[model samples]
Target chain A: MTAPDPSPAHPVTGLDDVVHQRVRLGILTITHEARRVEFGYLRTQLQLTAGNLSQHVTVLETAGLVEVEKGYEGKRGRTWITLTAAGDQALAEEIGRLKQLIARVETTSTPEER
Target chain B: MTTDSVPAGADPRRLLSDVRALAHRVRLDQRLTWVALLVLAVATFVAIPFDYVGMDVRCVNGGSECQFSRDGVLYYWPAALLIAYTAIAFCYVRAARARGLGARVLPYALTGAALAVVFTTVWLLARVYLADPPTEPFPGWVMVLDRLVAPAGTIGVALLVLARLERNVALLVFTLGYLAVVLVPIDFGWTIHSSVRAEFIPQQVINGVVLLLGAAGFAIARRRQR
Candidate 1:
């Protein structure tokens, strides 16, 4: 008998490593639907410290996936983040890969087993 | 357990489920276009019942001195659409929050307020023109234009919001399609003694068309999303 493939039954070769990070994935998904997201709001939602969120945001910014704007909202300084076109495309691709994963698993397993 | 690494015990199904859940949240929020169309449907239905434009019959200068009896704009449709849009805008703000997006409500509120102001201004101008004896005799087109202005202005606000905020092509198309319905004749030139049944029926038909269109847009969007 032929040996079975040791690799995962559902391979997601197109998965974006930049977006696959849990927190960064969260950030991209949130900003994809919003016009712009405040830095503070992203931190709160992701439950990350300011330093941690800023680091991830910097990585995204460097990749040209997100834009960061610093300005004053009234008297207080505020930072806003939004996905660039590339970021939007990346998120779409990530979700497409995820959907493929789900579809593959669904088809491979019986309903009762699933 | 670290930020970069998946848990050692994590099954692929479990990991995939978590990712799926997050994507589902974003997808649900992205469906705000359908919510906007639903708002239009509700607004049209609510506005349909109040289609008749009631005129202020009170004389202004002296007894029987008023040039027109039904001059002031009732603005039933505009009010309905405005209310629905405002409500939907709030829903959008909340949905964004739920999906980990930060959005301010002030802009949405301002959009609705501006629309109300525009509709009100058009109605007031039509009323003033009707009240004046000098301008009322000619330019029947002015009355028709004024009547068209309310819904046009309402849809204009909708279009602006859709363009800047929603950015949904199908919703934009439906809003534009609604303009054809608004173009149906409104008899603002009718005298105080004229019957409103003629005015009422066409408006009801227009409202029906709007409701159907809005409902269809919502359904198609929902289906495509599925």
Candidate 2:
């Protein structure tokens, strides 16, 4: 009989490819907190150029993580973004994995590093 | 297509910290509350002249004596409250649109208006059934009820609802402070002994001052956050 490897799996393995990127994760988090955030607001908050934010948002939109609605507030066109249920769950899971990763790092550090 | 995996080079601790900081900034950008509080404070002050000038005296004991009361507030308060609620809603809508953020303010405004109407109806009914030209003081409980239904108390209750809608701890704290001022019996001792009349100033003035202070505090905090 052979014994399987006893080492724990890395928390990074649980991170979602669609959500792990820093900018996309920020978009998810802001939309989640604000419920429905405007595209301009997200761009400003993330400090990303319009094109950069649009690209990231497009990626998230295609992944079904966020929904974008384009409408006019008075005479100006505005776009609003909202997180989907799956997106919310993904964010929660990502945060949980990040916490596990942080804890793992702390515990594995040597006594002098502590 | 999915985005790339968490950048292998990125630090998880810094990423989490950034997410938390962004959330905190969003939470602090409560742009509409100060406007709402300021409108309510102004409404409270606007009622003073009506209260001071609109006096009603009813003769008792076959016209040998009379009782005085401020009847104008009874008429003015309800309408003023409705207008204030509407203005609050309008300010929230405009600010949300301008800032490109969505806030659940309609419910707060509607709840405030509904509460004002309910309190007004209760006060009117109480006057009709229990205390119209009463020969004696109202019971202790009735007095307490009177305080709760007053304009200042109604505003306090409404602001509590606003605090919940905005998810603002500071606003909640301010609401409690305002409610304490309204609920606790504190006399400012403003008495005018004039030939026109002698009476203690209305307590709504104190409530108004508290609301103004809350508005100023929120404004300052908001500027600092910005």
Candidate 3:
């Protein structure tokens, strides 16, 4: 429940844990480029069950990182998901932090590690 | 601050690699679209100059006359291809944005406008304005090749890109439409020279098959996902 540190040197600690989770991170990365993703498409890509994906999506929705839409395509019910502005920003910051973490590792590693 | 908070067994290198892969996947379509554009651009550059070089006059009834005809055949084919390539790139980028399936009309309109401009400029330079008239009748087969090369590369690259993106119908429509546009007209109206047809037809056929196969793969992948 701490605010993300604004300084570049402390990037990793500020990483949004919500976006740090692998499946949700994947969803955000995919949806950031797509106009919106169908629920089925997301489920298939992430290899998550209907219930599992719904749970992750609920977490994202609760955090205001994603918006879910329900409608019907032809005779079948359909769900579509898209990242919200906050979600997009969170994903960007998370990626930036990951890059910074990698840079830190590179700088601090021993010669044998290199 | 210490790296202790990274938790046990957390590998920074692996995390970076994973995120990089994710980003690469997300941007695949855009990268493919640019490749398609670049391929067409290079093909046009190489093909047009070869077709236009050493042509000095229009042949009227087997007599070389200093007539006011530009290399109309040469100019028109590349012009058409340029319009087509640009249209496809613009459409692909927009469709990747997912407004709808083959939905936007602006690219098509822009293509028409581009062709008109090319036609007008080439015409003005070669005929009306009398800047520099072409020396001879441009070869029909070269024009045919020009028509084929650009779309072949543009759509060919697009097929590869869309296959990765898992956009089944878009890939199918684009492949089929490419075949129809590039192959059908040449077969019916322009295949007058056997030598020209022999050289280019087989290549076009190969391109068509590759595009269709790629589209089919995407379709299969999409079906499995559904």
- Across B127-196, the per-residue lDDT of candidate 2 in tens digits comes to 6786546788778777766778887788888888888877788899988878877776454565454422
Error of model 3, residue B69, in angstroms:
4.0
Chain B only: TM-score of model 2: 0.82
lDDT of 3: 0.56
- Cα lDDT of model 3 by residue, A32-108, tens digit: 76647768766766677888889888989999999998888678787888889999899888778777787887787
Task: Candidate 1: list runs displaced more than 4 Å.
Answer: A1-33, A36-114, B1-28, B51-82, B102-109, B133-144, B184-194
Write the residue-wise lDDT of candidate 3 on B1-226 in tens digits: 1111234225656665666665554444333333343444444444434334423444477544334222433455456555655666575656544421222233433543455455455545545554554567568775544443444434443443444454335554655655455543434343423332133444444444444454455446545643
lDDT of each: 0.62, 0.80, 0.56
- Candidate 1 per-residue C-alpha lDDT over B146-174 given as tens digits, one digit per residue, 9 for 90 to 100: 54566544654555566455445665666
| Ordered list by lDDT, greatest first | 2, 1, 3
Best by lDDT: 2
Cα error, candidate 1, residue B94 (Å): 2.2
* Residue B136 local lDDT, model 2: 80
Residue pairs in clash, model 1: B55-B70
Complex DockQ per candidate:
0.15, 0.42, 0.15
Residue-wise C-alpha lDDT for candidate 1, range A18-97, written one tens digit per residue: 77667787788777655577787777656788888898899999999999989885697778898999999988776676
Look at candidate 2 and tell me the lDDT of residue A84. 95
Worst 10 residues of 3 chain A by lDDT: A6-15
